[model samples]
Target: LKGQIHGGVAQGLGQALMERVVYDRQSGQNLTGSFMDYSMPRADTMPDMEIFSNPVPTKRNPLGAKGAGEAGTVGALPAVVNAVLDALAPLGVKTFDMPATSERIWQAIEEARA
Candidate 1:
C-alpha cells in the first residue's frame, strides 16, 4: 500500500511537471508521436516521497478495505500547480496556464519583467 501510494504520487508529479503532448495547430497533426519527442519524467526527476496514511475502515466493504492507490495522485496535481504559481508570485506572475513547462515559466518571468 505504501509503495502504491508513492507510485501514484510520482505519476501525478510527472504529469504536473514533465508530461505533455505537442501538436501542430494548423494541421492538427501530432508533434510528439514518439518517446524521443515526448517528455516523461525519469527516476532522477522524481522527488523523495514520504507516504503516510490514516486508515478509516468502512462498513460498506465486507473486508473493510480502503483504496490509497490513486489518492496520492488526486491531491498532488493541483497542489503542485499551485505551489509553482506560489513560487512565481514574488515575480508578479499571476496567471498560470496548463503544463507550466520550463519555457512557459521563463516566458512568464519575462512577461512580468516587461
Candidate 2:
C-alpha cells in the first residue's frame, strides 16, 4: 500500500512538472516521438514527498472502503502549479501555464521585468 501510494505520487509529480507531448505545427506530426526526446521525471529530479492518512469507519458499508487509486496524481498537478505561481508572485508574475520548465520560467521573469 505504501509503495502504491508513493508510485502514484511520483507519477503525479512527473506529469505536473515535466511531461509534455509536443507536435509539429505544419504536418501535425508528433514531435516527441522518441523517449530520448521526451522528458520524464527521474529520481534526482523528484521532490521530497510526505504523505499522511487518517482512516474513518463508515456506517453505510461494512467494508468501510475508500478509494485512493488516483489520489496522488489528482492532487499533485494543481498543488505544484499553485506552488510555482506563488513562488513567482513576489517577482510580479501572476499567470503561468503548465509544464513550467526552467526556460519558460526565465522567460516569464524577463517578460515581467520588461
Give the winner by TM-score.
1
Give residue 9's lDDT in candidate 2 (0 to 100).
78
State which candidate has the highest lDDT: 1
Worst 10 residues of 1 by lDDT: 40-49
Candidate 1: segments with Cα more than 4 A from true spot: 56-64
- Per-residue CA lDDT of candidate 2, range 1-114, in tens? 445566677777777777789999999999988889888777676667677778776678889865567667777778888899899989988876568888778888887898
The residue-level lDDT of candidate 2 at 3 comes to 51
Q: Tell me the deviation in Å of residue 80 in model 2.
A: 1.5
Candidate 1 achieves a global lDDT of 0.82
Model 1, 1-114: lDDT tens digits are 777787778777877877788889999999999989988767677788777778788899898887776767887788998999999999999876667799989998899989
Each model's lDDT: 0.82, 0.78
Residue pairs in clash, model 1: none
Structural similarity to truth (TM-score) of each candidate: 0.77, 0.74
User: How displaced is residue 94 in candidate 2, in Å?
Assistant: 0.5
